[model samples]
Target: MMLLLTQQAYADDWGCQVMLCMSNPAGPMAVAECVPPMQRLYDAMSRKGFQWPTCDLAGKPDTPKPFKLDARPQVPGNLAPQTTGQ
Candidate 1:
């Protein structure tokens, strides 16, 4: 069905972004754009009876496993930082 394909398309896009973001040597926190997609994936995984979405084009499904967000120290003058401070 068109609806299923549409959903799959969004999932693939989100999965690919998650893959690239998680792979960044600077870490996903350093990539501002990574948050939303990662959050979406995290939410889905957190739900009961979660199913892993197919992301063949994004590479191995086993990779980019959900990770805890690291706490970063707050810097003066910066109103906001991507990650919460310890």
Candidate 2:
């Protein structure tokens, strides 16, 4: 029981690290420390069929929510009629 909890905690921490490394503007490969975590992520995703991990530490939601979009365009005016040059 205790070992399970410990493993869960470790996975959470690793997930958080992976999330941060991925979000880096320079990209994951640029970070020397991110290589192993990235490889682990790839292996887990490719072989174990695991979903991308979320970071609770980074305030990530368990499931992604779709953003709401306006049904209509914001601009009210239509474009002027096109004129061809002689």
Per-model RMSD to reference: 12.8, 10.6
Clash pairs detected, candidate 2: none
lDDT of each: 0.69, 0.70
lDDT by residue (1-86, candidate 2, tens digit) is 35543333365577777876887779985798788888888888887557877766564476565356656535547854444782
Backbone clash count for every predicted candidate, in the order shown:
0, 0
Where does candidate 1 clash, by residue pair?
Answer: none
lDDT tens digits, residues 1-86, model 1? 35543333365576677777777878775877778877787899999998765556643575666566767666689576665565
Best by TM-score: 2
Candidate 1 TM-score versus the reference: 0.46
